[model samples]
Target: MPSTSTSLSPLSTGLARATAGLNLCHENASEVWHQRPPLDFLQIHPEHLIQEEGGTYRDQLDDLRHAYPIVLHGFGLSLGSCAPLDQDYLQLVKRVLKEHPEAFFSDHVSWSSLSHHHFHDLLPLVMNDETLDYLVERIDQAQELIGQPILLENISSYMRFRDSTYDEPSFINALTERTGAYVLMDVNNLWANAVNFGENPLTQLMEYRQSSVRGYHLAGCTRQQAGDGDVYIDYHGEAVHETVWDLYEKALRHFGPWPTLLEWENHVPPLERTLQEVSRITRYLNDLSVAPGAT
Candidate 1:
């Protein structure tokens, strides 16, 4: 049985909390546990641990809980949806956090559900004042229910809404200003969007200083044919791109080396191979630590 406490402690509240981490995948979990890769913390989608309805804990979750500090990243909240927040989903999230009270949880700034239908991919939001107000209300309710502030991640968007009033950083800044939610800055997604949309990643990163960014996601994407042009899809199925790594180092210089996790979801690889990606993060952190003017 898990604890019933509602207290949520800040895991990476301070600057430079940890350098490298891995997203615990279901397929490689047993091997990861047996091999015990060197990670500062382990992240999991809490949706994987508890059943949607019964809220029962899986044995694997219990095992992992005893091994390392957990960070919960979720995709089902649909925080930007016009459809009301799913009470059952909120309950499921609350249940997991109650047990792993030290864990900090996060979800996307986009929607996955519309009315009763659920989409497999995270869809983009309009990014206007109307959407911002709706998200603020829902995020407030969720924080009240979950007993802590939530981190919201920016998703990779294929297209932008014409009526959007704010740029990505400005939109996220407004949300953090209004609701006090932290950010799980996905550097790869930023790079993907930059490539797909003709934007500058480093410039946007400097503008992202307004939010409380506590974590980072580094992953690879696929370049797919979009008619006559090439669009980068955030597949998270390959190695971290060189462009993303360059931006990540700039981000570390800007954001002070927050807990960075390597997310390899699609074609999951061996634990050692996965750790190699994490090792890159380690090398960057090591260099940054000794760099001039670094604290």
Candidate 2:
């Protein structure tokens, strides 16, 4: 049977400490309470929550659970690598899930490490039958060990494999069908690919297995023009672009309102700006629900 004890530990400790009046102040209490309208979800890096200093990371996670729904978005899982998945990384992820029972976990579909050497970037995967089978088997093992289905996200790519046998949508559709895992569709990635590769991102997204998508991600990109070719990098440092916003609206129509996370990892802005962007996405989703002709 699945256990919540393993997942609820961190939240329990955090809540206890928070209630002890340690960080509370008269001026900030109302603001904190109002903004803390049950965070839809928070994606955390494993390094931030998994520490060598013993209980500090665990304690911090416990406190975060009190105010927000936590999701473990791994930066180093490297699911599509030809090399075997890291056993130590998998064990750490399991421990985190056990510590935050309320958390949902996910990782990128791209690989970051090859032959045990870490590249620190989400590298594109070759879409082929062999790679598909390998990923399906690994996902099966991961699910067996973790006792829950995992979610995978599509990654942006600058180059395509010469030998790719499947398109991005077909690859993701097949993997989800074979492994029964969910998806975290990143809107910015879709837009970036469409702009760079001349593929209709909405068409690719429409080909996805609708039942497999659990959430969506929105982030900013950096646009550059070099000679006659233009490129957009998924920088996550600024406000979302109009093209990405349009794609997000399409996603809202296709998938309904699910958990959405606005990623602002670089060029860290004021807290208010980040909050405002999140609020804008939230309102956009809300408006979609009420809009006529919306499915």
- Candidate number of the best lDDT: 1
Counted clashes in each candidate structure: 0, 9
In Å, residue 156's CA in model 1 sits off its true spot by 0.4
- Cα lDDT computed for each candidate against the true fold: 0.80, 0.71
Candidate with the greatest TM-score versus the true structure? 1
Per-residue lDDT tens digits of candidate 1, residues 1-295? Answer: 1112224333333223656878876666777767776677778886675442322234555576568767789988889887788887778777877766557789999999887887999999999988888888888888878777889899999989899999999999888767767899999998888878898888888888633788899999998888889999999899999999999988888888677889997888878888999988989988989999995
Query: In candidate 2, what are the lDDT values of residues 189-234, reduced to their tens digit?
Result: 9889888888887888798887777778888999888569889988
**Model 1 spans > 4 angstroms off:** 1-16, 51-58
TM-score of 1: 0.89
Summing lDDT over every window of 10 consecutive residues in candidate 1, give the lowest-scoring window: 1-10
- Identify the runs in model 2 with alpha carbons over 4 angstroms from their true place: 1-38, 51-62, 292-295
TM-score of each: 0.89, 0.82
Error of 1 at 111 (Å): 0.3
Task: State residue 285's C-alpha deviation in candidate 1, in Å.
Answer: 1.9
